[model samples]
Target chain A: MMKGNTRGTEAADGKGSGPGRFLIRARADTNIQLGIICILIIILMTALQPRMFLSSYNFESMAFFMPELVLLSIAMMIAMLTGGIDLSIVGVANLAGIAAGTLFGFLAGEAGVGGLGTGAVILGVGVGLIVGVLAGLVNGLLISGLKITPILATLGTGQVFIGLCVVLTGGPAIVGFPSGWTWIGNGKIASIPVPFLLFVVLCVALALLLERTSFGLRLKLIGTNPKAAVFAGIRKGRMILWSYMLTGALAAMAGILLSARVNAAKSDYGSSYLLQAVLIAVLAGTNPAGGRGNVLGVALAVAALTLLATGLQMMRVSNHLIDFVWGAFLIAVIALNSLSARKGL
Target chain B: MRVLRNSNVVIALILVAAMVVIGLINPAFWQLSNIFSLLKANVVIGLMALGVLLIMISGGIDVSFTAFAIAAMYLVVRTMVAIDYDGVILPFIFATAIGGLLGLMNAGIIHKFHMIPLIVTLGTASLVRGLVLGGVGTSNVNIDEMPPSLIELGRANIVTLERANGTTFGLTAMILVYAALAILIHLVLTRTMIGRSVYAYGADPEAARRVGFKTGRTMIFVYCTAGALAGFAGLLHSSMSWLANPRGFVGLELDVIAAVVLGGCSIFGGRGSVIGTVLGVFILVMIQNSLILMGIDMTWQRVVVGGVLISAVAITALRDRRSPA
Candidate 1:
């Protein structure tokens, strides 16, 4: 908002990027720091209990978790990069999964639809994905078009979406999904989990879209300086809408897979994912301030979190303990990030 | 016409209309005893809303408030019962102190470590909740041994007004607490230097810093105040219910947040008042009460609340569109 741009002027005057450049480098250092921490954690786990930490079962569990956790983080990353937070991701996923489950139930019923057929299930999942995108659209429209703060906008819509899911299901779980649908959740390709593969593929596609696309540039510019971007002929409102929608769609994808894996959909689906997805985003070094971060970091953060949870489970820790540990980790990261941001990093 | 469109005036009108409608529909709802009972039930939440109002005005949030309160309640109840401390004031003071300490921890983490408030609060929320649950074990704290005097204020109205229809309404400590807090917070916001600093900080922390505000220290104070209020609310909750459930205030942060937002507080962190928050809570509670009178089921209650929450935000969003970011 200031007329004089210190960072831009320094760069333009050939002052070797100045303090702002150093700040960017420092941020990159933080990423490397997080990476090292992850490796060290893995090493410590191995040294403490080699037999258990390196077991095939642990790896298998991690593989199974890769899809939902990674995808959720990616969704959050997209929103974060756009200088907005999608508090509704978990709600959207829950609603989408419920939609799929409801559709499966309807198709299986005698409403003139085939029972448990591949075609019916596929159609149901497709509709579920659309529901997710629609949820995002609502969030986007309310936030960008109507100028609502992202937090309040999503909070409101999230409640509505969650309530809708409850109303649709009457607060029950929908089970008896088709066997073929489980493949999306559990099948393997070359001994690698299908979901994990999808996770990797989504990361690559998103990374490319983010790093090498005009859309990505626009988003970064908007995030860094919305007013400047607007002055530079960028459509800030439209981009925000698009990003929220993308986040919604990605969360929906995760929801669809979750429904398939669990073989059911419940009204309260994906409630636990909120804290986890947020942690993944923050840990991955995706600045909630936006215009920074990449998918690779987010992917690793997801791995680290999932590992932490799995390790705790392997150590036979109680669910309550696991929750506490996760919370402590989140606070630690947030505090660390905030300090770093203050240091002009 | 424009004056009539003022949200506060409109809300006041709505509140008055709601009371009249409820009174007409069910005179029983207007009974002094029942009215006080409802007011008591709302007091704890109303107090928490006041705390939240401060945090919201200061441009930070503590989702962990509920968790902190739960932990405090556990400590207070367990200590009171275990130590055979008969006096209510001492335990309440200790609980409030513990709650304040937790708030200080949250502020310390954010101010000292430089982390996002939401993430820090969320993590702390989970951590506190987990610890409380783990400490309590599978069995809920038995309040059968609770002090009767403390329990009575939560359960029975102190002042009753009887009607010819054999129904009565009464004033309770809960209402007194609410009214007192409302006045206190309003005065604090309007009359105190710290309160002005809160607004200035929220309005523009960068500017506040330039103007020589004690950003870190003030945040600690604000959060601690919020924490203390939450603790007091938790105590009241336990006293009223005569039990401290580990799952108390589950998803209550959302309700508080919704109330604040609906009361026209900007989630962006500046420009809200305790009066607005109280009104927000009142509107929400009134809606719930009205729905019950209309024979609306609990299942539909969620839908109605959700709709109101979204609509409020949407309305705010529309207003925000007219202003430059």
Candidate 2:
């Protein structure tokens, strides 16, 4: 592992509450703000539809839907930690799912439609994970290796990945993941959905990795101050490359959950999730410039947005309007963060 | 080697080389009719690209222009249908004005709050597109409902060509509009005070501010002009296609931006010529249109475009690193 200056490494100390501000200023601690926002959304939803918003069924459904989004958001957050973004996350997710689903269909053949044996599902997942890492490696190569800007490199690769998906599927959905694979996305244990449990375990593990591990520390320090990190003998390029690989792997996990839940994979599925993930990451207080964010904030944001979206849909709002609301919500948070920051200044 | 230092020459050389190679492989590429069609195809994208060029020169990026274009086109056509109005100029003006207004929103947020243009535009893209589809209406304006004069305006041609095989391809006069705007932008950037300020600001905002340039005004002008251009391009598109879909140009920002960059405009702001951008747009347009003519799979279009963009950007990035500012 690359080590930074022992003294200046405090910036990469992985503080849940830190001074890396994306907007005008982030003084009130993002977690608290996100917590408040989540509570407010819940209160509003409950007030608007008491029975529907509070039902166990609603929570379960949201649990099933929220994991993929949460996973993607956290993936986005970590990329942000390097002061770089992975716009290719959506493309990676879709591609990973396509690879995995294709594997499933190939293995299952004609007679094995009901469910695949455990081994095939595991192998398929491994394939997906490898594809995700490869995609990320390509991104890292373009951004870090070729010295291209992250946004442009990722943007280009995203198109390539999406086009590959299109060419692979020939413009149709790939269906029929075995029941065993689907169980990871749908089944429950002790009244808790499998997806939600996985989400919890994975996110908490990520938090620990980011907070306690030196690998994650090097990444944040790279984001906080590239020159300083370089002076501190950090392997910046290798670290960034590995970080994107990690990011891709996380996106793949999200893709797997999504494909399992929907019982299919396609190039065009979850097109809108890209914008929402960006929105949630920003809302989670993940500074766009990097070095400040945590899993807790992202989790709260995911919960809030999911509830907000579900409640709005329950009110019979158009999906486009919900998108508008989310956009407005993002801008509103940005403005408020800035305005309050100005006051602090 | 010295000439290669100028990216304009580099881009122009690439464009010519591509044309020669493609024309060699498929002689149909150099046909006058095909060339004119490519020109016509470039008009809308060219206009949008010019606006984006200006913003790039001012050190900002906008992804919301496509949304702006669609909104302006949809809202104007919807209003035209409702009022039973059928005229080219009015819709043109309305679209441009609506686009300008939305551009003002972007400019305001960015200049006032000092926010990044990408995020600001992303928000507006969602907000504006959603507003149009959700709040206004999602149903498209049918051709029959469209104003006849607008359609006629789009159909106007400066010259008509009849091929040996009996196919007719008239060069749309919209190319004239595009050319006039491109020339105007060139003149403004080279000859006007505001344009110089835009370049200056993009080169270094702090230094420009120190030099007493109206940094805020320049930013506003750049975004607003970009918006207006996008608006006009939108109406032109609908007129050309003879329909209005609120969801059209959904992901065109990538193509337009790629074209602008491919043209030699620096994404980091400043240091790009209008001619460079024009050549860049033509190269991209040629690449896109030639694929169909060359019988390549349409699905490969994205991959090819993306590949071209990456290589182009990589070349620029590596060269810049070698001789960085």
Candidate 3:
């Protein structure tokens, strides 16, 4: 508590001094620790399995693994910044992917507009956004109109969304994604992967949304103190709802990209992202209970996860064991976040 | 007058009506065979719900209940199989003990660090599941290789009844376990001083402390008991399915939670009943079974559960506003 207050005081003065420097250092320590661990893992892997870790093929493999989660982490980062969480992001993404795939293959194909052309692509993108917006609207209404807790509301939505994905896909994978679609997932712009570029654009846009705009400022305040925000004439309900909707849209976009990348949209495609996305948010120092965290923190955390996963694969860790590792990392970071939050660090 | 005033009683009546309607639509549903089948599938989830009720009543949530159970089951089966432990009871004891330890760890961490229960449990859940998967290697228990004693415990039945359709229906031993647990929990929550203390802590920790209740200790006990129940549930899951899949209970914790909430337990802690939660579990399971029987797409199952959960919470919130405590 004392440390927390001291940090608060320093921020108030718009300056740093005394233990404030140490506090800032400790906060930055989150990023440093992640970077160091990531580097250490990569180094260890390179030494232990130089043939695999140093190969360009492995680098390309890492690229394939990074996009969906990176996109999810960013979506979750948006909601985390506003002091809310979008647990339904993975489910929403999966559903959106299914929606895009089904439209391209079944509905559009039946309508004779499914030829590998611009029209089918536009239809797919439109379907993704629509599904995303609808999913977000459900979240918004449940939290605002129904007054359900975000956790419970999203848990239900997650179930519903996944179930819908299953029903739409008939519990099978939508194979034969258009070559154009795969290109988006496997493509590059200016020698940079499209997904990576998308990540950059999303981070910049979200960072601006959170740090620069008055709405963003209001949201942070609302997250910090909803009652105070309401007293300050901010529409707390509307803002919270907006945050959830925005998260849904981002999740949908991620889903569309995931479908393009995987070359097949499966019902359970986004299930794995559920743990990783939330872990990224918390690892970025975002509080699960709302209020406090940032885009840079989330981005770094995503990079760490991508690197870690890649390193694990290079080490020839079994996929099942890798899942175990993922779960452990999530728990470790969350526990640390909780401890830090409680101790006012 | 009290009966009319009791929300549980009202909800129970509604459940009965729903059940009767379902039975009317499908007479086979009322057959002893169908009832037993439903009971078999739901017993584990029901037990888990009881555990969750304790946590919720104590002003906390245990998202890790399913994960804890999964880990406990994995450890118990793996250790037993490896050591060639000869008794059915040993496996259960081993599983429940592991669960209890995990629960205690959760209670200890939450109380000591003053952390949010949800986040802590969320992390622990993942950690526990990871330990299981990593240690056991994603494999299913080959129950066919199990000793006769263990199989007997898993498949044993009592209370067989001859139906008009000339089919005999028998209740599995698992139902008896669930019933015994329900009775024990109901008694403990209502008849014991510790039980009252749990309610007090949940309703208002500050006030309970002012009245000399050891709120922290009570919380730890609640969590421990929750863990034990979850372990038992996990064992039941393995027993009924005859396989302990490493994937663990996916979304089962949420269903347990939904059951607890539907049982009229407040999410805000301090108020819940084992009986209410048990009834809630049956209601939820019945809804799921009924929907499947009606040929309603399984996808809509989640939508309904979500809708019901939201509605239940909304109703509770509204009731609280009308009669603030």
Candidate 4:
């Protein structure tokens, strides 16, 4: 708790801190330890499968695929900061994409590929973002206004949203997103993939929101202790509602990129990403009970997981085994962290 | 003030109302055939729900029971197929044993690390599932390879009804198995000393520890019992279906948890009952099974279920808040 507060102050005045203090902070942070692990994984994978892992083609694909998971992970992190989880994020994403994709079907009819103008794409995306925000708003209402538990409420909403995805498309992929729309997922700014650039820009923007804003600080206080936050007059319900909406918007952004990358949206697309995002968020040291997490930590966790997944695939390890490895990794991290905490005592 | 009125009564009324509504929508839904099938479907999910109810009563939440169920089911099926064993009793026992051991692992981690039960179980669930698929191989055992005796047991029923055209439906004897187990659980939770200890522990873990209850033992027993139930359900599901897929029972934890909560088992723990839970399971089973009878498209089934879950909890939560029970 003391360390959390110190870091709160550190981040608040982080602009004044020199590189020396930064190094100390890095050493003090578990996320930086995770960063070292990420480095180790990259080095090990490159050594083991230089031909596959080191290729520009592999890197390019990674750039495209990694952003969706990264975005999802951060979305999850924000919700966790409020001591709640949005199990509906994956559902929200698919629903948002389906909104955009289905709009394309309506506007362009049978000729949706390159037939639509850039304006049509923007309009469709706008509808998708609205869908995402609205989904988040409902989750916020259920959790805050109706007083339902976050996990259960979101789980139910998730089911409803995923069901709506199937109802919308009727059990098939909605293909034919316009070329310009796909560019958000596929295009490059300089040599970097557009998705990755978007991911970086959003992460920075979110970091600022969390670090510099009253909303972020209040969320942290609520996460740390809800009663104390209430005592301090934090208007907990409004904060929770907004937090969920933000989570929804982030989920929608990830969904839009995902469908664009694949050029289609389906009900079951990225079905595993929900739990995987949970795993990633917890691995980033976001307290599951709420009150603590950061963008940098999430970025590192996403990097580590993406690399590990790619490396395992390259080595011909089945996806199931990789999941097993991730589960094991989570427990091991918990155990090791506890052990280290004991040693400090 | 009596904290809140017994939610058991409230939920029971809801369950009956749902049944009546469905029956009104489709007269055929009242047929013994549909009811029998519903009971059969309820067995797998119901067993798992009963086990989770125990965990929740201990102030712990688990999302790993589905993993345990699948693991036990897949491992037992794989072994039986390999060894050419045919007896139904042995597979159930083995499945129960396997599930108990996996549950022990979950208890061990949560106990040793003092971590959140949900996250720990989630990890173990993923890990165990991975181990089964990766180490044991991810192949579905075809019906032809299934043990003859096992299939016979799964197909066994107390009574069979012949349709006008000659098709038949049986009230799967599995309902008896479910009833027998549920009765045992109900007795344990009500008539036994350990059961009272579970309630005390859930009501306040710290106080329970200070009051001299064996906290660790209660946790172990609760999780082990739940895990064993999951394993039993998993194998029965396979046998009843006459096939075992390595990827079966995905996302079932949420459903069972939903049922448990609907039954009035408080998510915060120390409050639940078997009768209420059974009724809750029946409600879910009816909703899912009667989707066909209601003329609802299959794709919309989940939406209906999700909608019901959210509203039910929301209503109950609002009521609870007024009294702060």
Candidate 5:
């Protein structure tokens, strides 16, 4: 890993006469642009609803919604970095939630109130994580071992996961978790939401993983140019598999949190989040074609979009129109980015 | 010998095997009436599959067709109801033209930006669906006001079979329409100059461009044609089901794409056929129908379809690896 870092810095310095200068400058530009977008959204939203938008209650609610979007966006960013996509993230999340919810139901029974125990929560969460990992493993095997295109492979597997969820619950929401389970989703630590704290911890961990580890560097190399990475003696398939697995695990964590927050699990829960996750990742400057990403950009993008959504809801805009705005926003952002890239900006 | 290695041949074999297995499980599946009804039920999907095949062959994809279809169909239906118009041709024209216009929107953006078709279409799909849902509101246009001609055309049968138990089965005008469209598309894809260019471009866009192929125009043509077909499918669906709900055809892209891919169309583009898509549609519809006949739960249908998609691609990939194409 140290050798890899030196090699990267040498290439940067050889061309630009400084170690990390060009890369850091480019990243700083992206961060600055994203920061501006965030501040602009805040100002615009606050202007629209001077009192409600800036209220502490609004912030708390936004905090509640931000974790799942943040986690899903991060998962999507990782997959995009590998020049692949996991369309199955939503499916994986729902499946993991359902698995955990079912475990809760089994331990607590239909009433789900008196049997609340800490052990049951731990067991349910464990089951959810394992299911998520297994789902990821299947996706990894299909993409790496069978040589399937990531998009189509995940699309198919996503359907299968959703189908499994539907079959398990018979097309109805599963509600019956012990009250203790809510702590992960709804409880607070030091006046901050637990889910938000978890989001921060995971984001920091992911940043460290991507920046400080050999695996992350290799994954990026593979994404940038597979042939070049292969020439450099990296095992491309293994890295791709690991990247997808990591995404699947993250998706499961989001799912578990969602189930805990809502106190119910269903196949269709967070179906809308699928496209939103992609939207957030792309907006955060995760190149859809792969090879470039930043955690800070993703975090800021999530904040901006969440603010936009919450503001629209407060203004009484229909949910469907909000979806339209998201779609239009994605296209506009991508077009602008492409135009700038073409101009070599 | 060459036919044995053909991907179409492989798909045909799979379809035949599936049919045989289903037939063995429930011999009623072999009934001509059941088959015709099945074909009729899947005609909308079949038509959409043709458009998808064209896009795939031309090196792009449009998952937004379902949204376009529903939007066009709803517009036509709502207009007809508001004016109390009964003409069939006008509705069909309105639907197809609206669909084509939407496709043109997609083509314009994709061409200008040179974006990935999948992501572009994904965004457009959301935009289109959102516009319809938000603008039109979530309400079903009831069939009480449907034109007599449309309903009659929907029910018009080419042939009928009388059974011992008073049950009857036959092919509808819609099925014939589907067959005609399939044949027409097949001919156009195989015989026309534009079709050849589409194939050439799909095989290698840069090389085709260097050779002076009008890649942009061909892309527009492909997407517009797809949108028109989807519009037609949407109208057919409403005519058959007797309502045009804003939510109609939501998530139907998955079925259409799965069918086209199962028909041996390469997702990477430049490889597929109209006949292969027809066979693929049959295989999917058959699985669905057979599952119902066997009293299997409806949820399992998705699992089966998803499984088929994965296995088909996996098998093709394995074969490609062995041959090193």
Candidate 6:
């Protein structure tokens, strides 16, 4: 079965080897579709609320809010690339945030925002990164070593992580971080939001990692056909482990930004983001079966979804209605993708 | 000898060990009243687990059942309240029908699109939840507005025992209903042609198709059955709690799935039994009850449940590895 898929991908890849190669690659069609959808969304929003939709304030708010979604979608894309998923991203993000928040509280003392200093910020951020990566490593080991299915393994770990967070914070939000910590979340550099900039930098880095590196090639090959990958002498288990760990670290980074933006860390913060992240990754054209995804596609999807959400809010739509739209959109996209594939598109 | 080799036997042994340990820690755990209470509290989960078991056996999964249940039950209760109706049977019938229709929708989409069941169900889960939460407008429906007959049914107890202390325990009608459903499901799965088709499909879809089994119809039957059961569980849940809250069953899918998996129902599909699911439900409820009795923090319950699920999966995988194909 896997050998059949290898031949199919190879044949498809060969067909695209021509003069317009750079512009007409295998995924370019989906990228163009996404671009058109994004533009249509912008036009629709502008038509509905001409002033606010096109305003600088709205853009700034989107920039501020979109970083978390972008980072998470990227993390999700990496996992999906391995023909697996990391459902524990939300839990890991919140756990990492809570861990850093606790460290911040201890180092900065209970003197509120006044006692926070540079040392506290550095230490807290460092702790968050380590904890996040370690959590991902555990998920990797479960999937790769124990041979557990990715979905169930991460589902269990997600609950465990959230439970630990709840125990640590006793089911309340941890607040009162030093003012300096907000720099990562809310700060601006040359009028570009720091979080947004961080998102862009990560996107570029990941795009490089996924497209230009040998590791990236091997990861995609494994996803395309695990049996063929094994025959080619690739360490499938090790690749899966690293993929999950990378996702974990990225989730933690998003957590730090989230905590900084909200100025609090809670076990339940961003509980809704779990489903939304999956939606974005899928909408970005990351095949849930794995082996085909691009960072640029995910970034565009984030922008499109953020616009839709912001536009709906502006139109006085209830949050529940927005959720309904997202769910509908996901179904429509998947159905359309399947239909198009049947047409040999 | 063959029974001894079954994974369900190992699970049954584990359940016995857990019960013995809990009983040793607190003698009250062995009391008739406490056992009844445990069964009563877990009746809803057991019913849902049975439904999940069927779908899993057929190489499909429906995480959206909880959402379907909540929506069906809420709509039924609200309609009844609006019309000032006071019957017990009609509301249950309506809810179950609604649940089955929702399940049919899922089956239709999955069959038509040939999409992955897990992803499709995940999307539908969110879609259903969103529709209920948005369309219902009301967050909760009070029990006082429900039919007096249903409320009475909820309060009816068959065997009440008052302890020496200021506590009482009793068996409820809900437990009886759960037992009946479990037996019915067991019979259907083991003794019916449709059940055999479901198993064949799960074990190997291509082979089942080649054998001329109507895969689409089987999927529809399996999912609709699961949905109808979920609706029944929803009614039981609201009856017990005396309220119908749309958000009440939001995250309970994890528990249902966990229980089914723990019962030796392979997530890979085509390998499970109804009796095993019952044992899984009992073991989980017992663990939760034992933890409460030991005065442990409730937050730790999630950790323990999650840890047990992973460990169980690992052990099963290891056993499969050691056994020759």
Best by DockQ: 4
TM-scores of the candidates are: 0.91, 0.94, 0.91, 0.94, 0.95, 0.95
> Which whole-number lDDT from 0 to 100 does residue B243 have in model 1?
80
Q: Candidate 4 on A1-345: residue-level lDDT in tens?
A: 211122222222221122445433633486878889899999999999999998999888998999999989999999888778788999999999999999888998766457988998999889888999999999999989987777678988998999899999998999878998899999998888999999999999998998789888899778766778899999999999999999999999999999999999998898778778888887887766666688888988989999999999999999889889988988987787556545644
Q: First chain of model 4: TM-score?
A: 0.91
Q: After superposition, how far is residue A281 of candidate 3 from its true place, in Å?
A: 0.9
Question: Candidate order by lDDT, highest to lowest?
Answer: 4, 2, 6, 5, 1, 3
Model 5 C-alpha lDDT per residue in residues B211-279, reported as the tens digit of each score: 998988888989999999999899988988777888877667888888888888876567789989999
What is the CAPRI rating of model 1's predicted complex?
A: medium
Summed over model 4, clashes come to 0
Tens digit per residue, CA lDDT, model 3, A170-272: 7888886766677778888877788777777887888898768997778766655566678999987788788888888889988888888877788677676
Candidate 1 local lDDT, A1-345, one digit each (tens)? 211122122212221223557536744676687688778778877877789998998888688867887788888888877667788887788788888877776767764333466787678778978998899898898878777667667777877787788888888787767776777788898998888888888889998988889998788777666767899999888998999989999999998888877877776776767888888887876666566667878877877777667767777888887777778788777665555554553
Off by over 4 Å in 2: A1-28, A109-115, B165-167
* Residue clash pairs of candidate 2: none
Candidates, ranked, DockQ: 4, 1, 6, 2, 5, 3
Candidate 3 segments exceeding 4 Å error:
A1-29, A32-41, A110-114, A334-345, B1-5, B162-167, B205-211
TM-score of 6: 0.95
Candidate 2 residue-wise lDDT, B171-258, digit = tens: 8998889989999999999999999999888777777889999888898889999999999999999999999999899778989988
Q: Write model 6 residue lDDT over A132-198, tens digit each, in one string.
A: 8999999999889987777778888998898899888988899867777888898999999999999
Docking class of 5: acceptable
RMSD in angstroms, candidate 2?
3.9
Cα shift from native, residue B235, model 5 (Å): 0.9
The CA lDDT at B35 in model 5 is 83
Q: Alpha-carbon error at A321 in model 1, in Å?
A: 1.8
- Candidate 2 chain B minimal-lDDT segment of 10 residues: B111-120
The sequence of per-residue lDDT tens digits that candidate 5 reaches over residues A49-70 is 9999999999998888799889
Candidate 1: tens digits of C-alpha lDDT, residues B195-272: 888887777777888999898877887899899989988988888788867777887887877777778776666677
